[model samples]
Target: MLTLQRRQLVGHDILLARHGNHISTMRVDRQAGRVVAYLDDGSVDSAPNLITPGLPMPATVRSVLREDWKFFAVATACTTGFAGVMVAAAVALAGLSGEPGMTQLLSAYSGT
Candidate 1:
């Protein structure tokens, strides 16, 4: 069984389960305001209540595996590191280009 501490956020916040051993049981972030969840594959999954927008919120997470919930702390750390890299890239691009280009970047390397 899982146990999660309820969270409150004004904007987007993602939380994954500490336990990822079971692929069948999906971990999720219970959306209250503008929050949404991202799976391991980087796909989004929101609580049905969030999708409805005005309807009563259903309990998305029945139980939080105390063990599984802890793993989320690690995910959050990784996200932080990635965000730092993104910020540095954005800054470098701005410095070099003076503006964000509208063009999409094509891959430089092709598969064999």
Candidate 2:
């Protein structure tokens, strides 16, 4: 990853560009409206602007599936399986409690 940082040094704003173990410095010339990059070989390079705008990349369904389909599928399957187990358990318990089931339990608790 590339990271850019700015600091004030001796009344001048200096930009530091870091990538991995390599570090380089750049000087921001506000008066000239240009950014100067100092190279490792002691050569200076200048750019009109810091960042250039480019066209956006198109999103594809294959890319989306490649990135997250497995996770989504597993999550959905697990949720459905859990719900099925809970429903089956509730039905079994209701059957064991006889015809009234939860209604009978509630009436007994209410003393009516």
Candidate 3:
């Protein structure tokens, strides 16, 4: 007969089981809400939940970037630059508008 053991930790859960001569391990990350299973046959399976917004990357992307992480570095740099530009634009627009634009538009509409 095979037996299964389970352990619950603060931020994760682990399961261990044996079938015949093979042992399987499973881990669940509570924060990420993801599950990974390592089968006795040397196979790995993962299930990721959508606690965060954004589309999941395809398997092909992982395969292509497996050896080269410079792509990710460049991507991060581009994202940071884009965010900075957006913030600057917002600040400039706020400064340009201030209270004068609103007061002028209201006075014109009210005929005062």
| lDDT-best of 1 and 3 | 3
Pairs of residues clashing in candidate 2: none
Residue-level lDDT of model 3, residues 49-95, one tens digit each, is 34334743334444556746887889999999998997676666656
TM-score for candidate 1, residues paired by index: 0.30
Model 3, position 88, has a per-residue lDDT of 72
Ranking of all candidate structures by their TM-score, best first: 2, 3, 1
Which segments of model 3 are wrong by more than 4 Å? 1-66, 100-112
Scored by lDDT, model 1 comes in at 0.47
TM-scores for the candidates: 0.30, 0.35, 0.32
lDDT of 2 by residue, 1-112 (tens): 3223332232123333222122266666767656677667666666543233363223455555677899989999999999899767766676677569574543343436
| Candidate 1: tens digits of C-alpha lDDT, residues 1-112 | 3334454332222233421432233333444344355455656554332434575332335344443676788899999999898867756665666334521232122458
The candidate scoring highest on TM-score is 2
